[model samples]
Target: MRKLPNLFKFDEISDGDNDFKQVMVSILKKEFPIEKQSFFDAFESEKYKECAEVVHKLKHKIHLLGLEEGYILSANFENQLVNNSFELYEDFVIILETIENFLKNI
Candidate 1:
C-alpha cells in the first residue's frame, strides 16, 4: 500500500514532546469516531443543520491533524451542508476517508 502523507504537525504539537504526541493521538482516536458517527447520522437523516454542526466540530480535528488543505475544504463542506448542497459531497467524503485511514495508522 502507498504510504499516506503525514497527517500531524509533530513539531508544532506540544513542542514535539512524545507524551504530548501520545495524548493528542489518544484524543483523536477517541473523538474521531463520535464526530464521524454524528456526521453520518445527520447526513443519512437529511438533517443538514445537524450535519453542518458536526462538520464544524470535525473541522477543529482536521486542523489539529495538520490537514491544512482538508481544513479549507472542510470549511467549504460545512457551508455546503448548511446550504443543503450535494455538489461537494463526494470530495468531502474522500477527505473523510483519507483522514480515517490516516488515523488508523497513527
Candidate 2:
C-alpha cells in the first residue's frame, strides 16, 4: 500500500504561536468529519453538483494540509463531478482516506 505524505504544514500553522496551532487543530478536528460526511452523502444521493460544491469547500482543507497533489486531484474530481464523469471518484476516495488517516494520527 502507498503511504500518504506528511501533508500537514505544521510549521506554517505553528509560525511561533502555539495557541494558534492548537486552535487550528481544534477547528480541523471538528470540521473535517462533517465535511467528509457531507461529501459522502452528496455522492450517495447522486447529487453531483452538491458533490462538486463540497469538493470546492474541501479544496481549502487539502491545501491547508499541504497535499498539493491531492489538491489537484480534488480539483479534477470536482470537474469530473460537474461533467458527470465519475471516473475519478475512486481517486477522490483514496484521497479522503489518506486525509482521514492522517487526521487520526494528529
**After superposing candidate 2, which stretches have Cα over 4 Å from the reference?**
1-10
Each candidate's clash count:
0, 0
Q: Mind giving the per-residue lDDT tens digits that candidate 2 earns over 39-100?
A: 99999999999999999988878878878888898899899999998988898888888888
What is residue 47's positional error in candidate 1, in angstroms? 0.7
Candidate 1 per-residue lDDT, tens place, 1-106, comes to: 3223363575476786889888878888888888898899999999999999999998888777767777888899999888888787777777778878888887
Model 1 residue 79 CA deviation (Å) reads 1.0
Clashing pairs in 2: none
Q: After superposition, how far is residue 6 of candidate 1 from its true place, in Å?
A: 2.7
**Cα error, candidate 1, residue 16 (Å):** 2.8
TM-score, prediction 1? 0.87
Question: What would the TM-score be for candidate 2 when compared with the true structure?
Answer: 0.89
